[model samples]
Target: MIKGIYETHVNVRNLENSNHFYEKVLGLAHAYGQPERGNSFYWIGGERHAMLGLWEKEPAQVQRQHFAFHISLEDMKHAVEYLENKGIATRNFHDDDTGELYVFGWMPAVSVYFTDPDGHSLEFIAVLPDEAKPELGLIPWSEWERMHGRGV
Candidate 1:
């Protein structure tokens, strides 16, 4: 059987700044990293972690890369507010293909996309419902588990 996720690696331009963002801003702990290797790693929850590696290049070298983290509705709301107050820009999205996409009113698994201080595209998403909820935007994990699978 599968155990669990280990870590996801991402490249950064500034290891120090990325370290600060993941630690102070995201509240993740710095597990271990190698400056000589041009990489920094942050411990997320438990065994799960995220790696930030440093790289050097020109302007066009900055490509758009994005990853999403699942958060609860309340957390999502607070995060949106926090980012907005911090001057982080966020935009709303809608899907035309309801047959394939999930939505949660204004709350349907809301997502915010923005660049980190390093110009990396980072996204936070609250999972949306398979159907549109005009009033509520919360899609419980139980429902998602049934729709997707176990362990999600």
Candidate 2:
């Protein structure tokens, strides 16, 4: 039986650059890697736990993929600010027509989306408690917070 994902691998044009991004931007620790094979590994949870691997490839052909990292609500907020300060764009999918930086009310979570160096769609998500979950439709984080008296 499958317990959980142990690791995920993706190809990158430059291992060094991807390493820098994963380490500095995403704050993932660099785990041991096979330099001869042009591959680098990063610890997603812990030093020897869940991981993400970057394989160096010439003419890197990366298909856009979506993945999310579980985080606390506070961390999700901080992550959005950190990315914004770094000039990285973020997006959220809500029921309303207006585009925003966070998705809330639906999925019982708040998420902030951005792209990696290889154009992979990444998200930092914080799952909310059952009592706090909405019945339907997505709303902006700001709106959800305002309605719940959480404030920005």
Candidate 3:
């Protein structure tokens, strides 16, 4: 049976830029690289936990992708600023740079999104320790706290 996502891949136009973005900006450790083959590999959430593959391809050949990385709730709370300070713009689920984390109430998870050098959509998310509220759909974290009768 499947356990969790072990790896995911995305296409980038320039392997160097993508590597710098994933390694320096995102802090994913380099796992391997094949410069002649235009492929790069990185480790996420530490070695052997998860992997991300970046393959350099022609602009017309690249197919953009969207993926998320699991993090702790505390990190999710500061993700926006953390990214923005690194010169990456974080956006809401609506694709707006509102500097806020939205909760998918159904799973009661918090997520914030940003894009890589290749414009591939990437997200940092964490599951909240609360009951599911599917009816709530997607809402800001402040709203979720208020609904639970607590101050944000």
Locate the minimum summed-lDDT window of 10 residues in model 2: 94-103
| Candidate 2 lDDT tens digits, 40-88 | 9889878777999899887547676778888887787677678878777
Give per-residue CA lDDT, model 3, range 26-99, as digits (tens): 89999999999999999988999999999999999887788989999878767888998999877888876565
Candidate closer to the true structure by TM-score (higher is better), 2 or 3? 3
Q: Candidate 1's residue-wise lDDT over 1-152, tens digit each?
A: 86655566666666677677777776667777777766777665543444443443344555756666666655765665677676676554442222222334554465556667766777667764445555645444345445546322
Winner by lDDT: 3
Per-prediction TM-score to the true structure, in the order listed: 0.61, 0.83, 0.94
Report how far residue 81 has shifted in candidate 3, in Å.
0.8
- Superior candidate under lDDT, 1 versus 2: 2
Off by over 4 Å in 3: 149-152
**Model 3 worst lDDT window (10 residues):** 93-102
**What ranking emerges by TM-score with the best candidate at the front?**
3, 2, 1
Best by TM-score: 3
CA lDDT scores, all candidates in order: 0.58, 0.77, 0.87
- Total backbone collisions for each predicted model: 2, 0, 0
- Which candidate do you rate higher for lDDT, 2 or 3? 3
Segments in model 2 whose C-alpha atoms lie over 4 Å from true places: 94-99, 104-106, 132-134
Candidate 2 residue 22 Cα shift, in angstroms, is 0.3
Q: In model 1, which runs have C-alpha deviations exceeding 4 angstroms?
A: 1-5, 47-62, 94-108, 128-152
